[model samples]
Target: MNTIKNHIGINIFSKAILMMVLLYSFMTVSARNLKVESPNGKISVQVFNENNTENAKWFLKVNYFNDGKMAETISSIDLGLILSDGISFTDMKLLKSSKPLLIKENYTMPHGKSLQRHNTGNEVVFTFENKEKKKLDVIIRVYNDGMAFRYSLSGKGNFTVQDELTSYSINQETTRWAEKWNPANEGLYSSMVGEKIQQEEWCYPTLFQTKDNNCWFLLHESAVDGSYCGSKLSNKEDKNKYKITFPDPKDGRGKGESLPKISLPWKSPWRVIIIGNLNDIVASTLVDDVAPPSVIKNTDWIKPGAVSWNYWSSNHGTKDFKTVCEFADLAVAMDWPYTLLDWEWDSMGNGGNLEDALKYIHSKGIKPLMWYNSGGEHTWVSSTPKDRMLTHENRVEEFTKLKKLGVAGVKVDFFESEKQDMIQYYLDILEDAAQFEMMVYFHGCLVPRGWAKTYPNLMTYEAVRGAEWYNNGPEFTATAPVHNTILPFTRNVVGSMDYTPVTFTNSQFPHLTSYGHELALSVVFESALQHFADRPEGYYELPDEPKKFMREVPTSWDETQLLQGFPGKDVVMARRKNNVWYVGGINGENIEKNINIKFDFLDKHNKYKLRLIKDGKHDKQLVTDDSVIESADSVDVKVLRRGGFAAVIFSIIN
Candidate 1:
């Protein structure tokens, strides 16, 4: 990043030559500027000192380049470390800089865009010395489509973090998408020019698109351990500028939500920016790529599949463990793996028969999962607040007990706090639950920041506005069609989401959308534990064709591709499990529009059959498909808008 010029020698004095060599050596020793590039060489990052004058107040600047062209030129965006004892690291002296190193590794995920991916990147490490003689390292890594930088602090005493001065400054005309930072991730996603963002607080991975270059920027944090509170962008006078803000301290350290008295030997979450086209935007796994590897010792017992849950059937005959056992019968009939036992199952009527129910269900080869509160989740049923499990000891005890009872997993719900302590505590729950080989699902919490990569037992997360919202009001259900279409590209792009799709015959939810649309959700939403929000009777009453279709939907896939459509509009997605290909498309708009399915992605020579399921013009659940093609060598179909369509292709000749 520093400018170096070469002067050809014609006639040189001995003293001048010695001075030139000494100056060059000094510049090399300072080494305040460095550059690192991605493996494919599409992304570039440069860090440099902005001052070189006498009595210099040295500050660092970062610049990003895309395809050998300047994309963002951020200046004087200095890092900081402020302590409660009035100590500041903003004016730290650079100690040493390591040479850029290459990193590449292949990891398999239980569920995601693809089963496995080879993550490649290059990283540079720089150590800085503060006035207190304390030291910290700043590590920057660049991937093919993104980059991340973080502060690695190490010490003995509890560090009181008064402030974190990291910053992001981009172009003025960039459009942005983010909600006002809140305790819960329940708000709608709205996009506008930076200036139009009326709320001062902003959600993470807030997306932006440059007005000129067509380059995109998605900003967020990765591997946010328990030592740090959750963060979002603070309001700025210039809409293009954003800074990190933490949640308010519960211990009353009230100078505005700061990371209070905590251990110093911890690394802050990696501040990341993913850049590329919309496809890259939708498919980026940069968050998981930077997180630590699997902490679970035994992943063999962990499995992913569709789950039967009876909590949505308010008026049905389903109740407590008996209802779950009934769902298990459905799971057995469908060949699904598990049935989710909702909260208060331990104390409700027939709850005492949990062991007996488990005995029969286990004999039938169906696993049972129980739900628990995440420390603060209250209940109207027999469960009091004391039933909440917050400590590591509590989790181990309960998980061990459940394991003895032959329970397959636990759904921990209602985590109301985003403080770092709670974040760390939640992770500890997963780590301890791993000892019993139990799958974990998080609910009533923040959007996943790639924790599933570290804790593979964490099968799915429910931070989105999921199916449970339907019981609240019709307004909640009305916007669901569009919400379902938008989530895949937005919330789901980061990790596996628990948007619990497929609702049919819920007496509480009378306003139905489309049967074809509900069927397509078997492909649209990607969750290891796909809990269809319907009772056993609802599934049993279905026609044999639809019943078989629901039973065969794969929870995890070997590959996925976003075929067409935009955010909050329409989406067409294609996924594969082994040799079988499943295509699903949903239209979020009110008007009818035809979507042309492309076949070039399929195998050209292999004979394939197509089974079409399209929305009927008359009723919501009618499978009136007038467009079924069998024994096809190719793939192509047209789906109607405000509705949906689905297809499965196999060897018709076979």
Candidate 2:
């Protein structure tokens, strides 16, 4: 009897102990084992998934926390590609995961660089196995402002991706700043609620606002240096769910296109979702952070400054080397760096002797930038006729010749597609141009997603409806104010833009605009190569003070700040270069509004001279007022009706 009782008691005690151990193990594994946070702990990210036996095993879900509150709930999404064939990244099981990695880097940016940034982040890799037990990995990185995730496939096999399996859910109402996916993505951006975004595809770097979180979110892809086709968001059956769509036979703009077959062991671009307050949304350097670093061993040759353009002004063209020299003279007088010889230079009837023109421009202490066609010279957007779309030996030949000719840069235009081939071609040119130690400008393409970081020689891109579009008609030019106001938060926030600003000539505008508005663009636009879209008369005829202001205002900046206003209504932006600050404001209202422009952005302890440039209250011309005042943080100013104002502040030396 004693033996029987002792044996039973021992068995029961052992079972109870085993159960407790198992329970403890499960809880430990589930308690946010895959977690990462930003340096300040202001942002937090957690990786999660569903593990039900009936469904796909590897459905990736992400949750984000801002300031200890949940900004995004477990959002059902996958950051993997599904091939056109039977192969898929789903039906997967966990293989292994890397311990969290801390990356802190500080790289000095050359001239025209912003911030000289110190990048800090946390990275982790999650590995999975397909149904056949083939392996793939997803990399997620968390920055102080946002987060990015990408897919990686390894092993020896060819795969053509049919699409990417990516989706995200918002925790707030769906008002988003939407730019409807136009093949030529040069269309203006408009705001719409989430439900309204159904069925319609919008281009990337898309912005979303959620009232619940009081935050802004921007979506885009980065580090896309030839691993996959370019992509945008899409949804068909459900408005609440959006997925990644690749180029199709029915692709708009890059119409009738098909994606390329990706080679083995390739990695995809980072699908980034940047979120923060307006400051984070505007100043977030996620794209630049995720991109490959500069490949050029010596970056001193990369120069970013103001450029004189022969296009965008009906009053200017490369009609002859003499006329071209006239533009070059303006660059010289303004102390600008380069003169762009645009498209018409290819026609002998319209100044085809570019080689001679380059020589003359160089002699005048200004380098030259010539234009070329891209994407097989497609003419759907009034592309240059039979212009050089160099590839293979031809591209090398032209580049070598141009390098020897002392060309400073090349402007490649009309990239009408986002197919893998088209995207790769852009990379090829960037690499080649870097090898020759010359800068390049991009036109007629989608907005840049941080390629400038990879190829530091790449200066600026014209992906916005700039001053050149004023030639279309009254309808286009009339919206200039509203358009300008919308850009700082939308297009310009993502990267630098060449809006070809400050057309001071009144006759140039068929619609209503003021010299104040013209002057404001000098401060508002963010082109590394600011194109002063004015004829010689535009500057030469201006008062000496105003001309000096245009010449001295910078194209690049050390910092930028948004003072006040909303999209399409009004905007006040403050930018700093060295010790000086420039403030610009624009309005789209029928009547003028009174607002306080702050000088508090300056050190509160400092005294400064503030120069105000605005429309005259009773006159057709512009006005200026100068005052030496101790910084009280702000001053009252008026933004004129239908246009805007500009001002500069310089510290007064004791």
lDDT of 2 by residue, 26-111 (tens): 44444536666776665666655565331244544544456666655335565555786688876665656788898777765553
Weakest ten-residue segment in model 1 by summed lDDT: 1-10
Pairs that collide, model 1: 248-257
lDDT of 2 at 573: 82
In order, the Cα lDDT scores of the candidates are 0.72, 0.73
Superposed Cα RMSD, model 2: 4.5
Residue 510 shift from truth in candidate 2, angstroms: 2.1
Where does candidate 2 clash, by residue pair? Answer: 174-194, 600-633
C-alpha RMSD by candidate, in order: 6.2, 4.5
What TM-score would you give candidate 2 relative to the actual structure? 0.89
- Model 1 stretches astray by more than 4 angstroms: 1-33, 49-78, 92-96, 129-134, 154-156, 236-238, 250-264, 315-322, 350-352, 376-388, 506-512, 619-641, 651-654
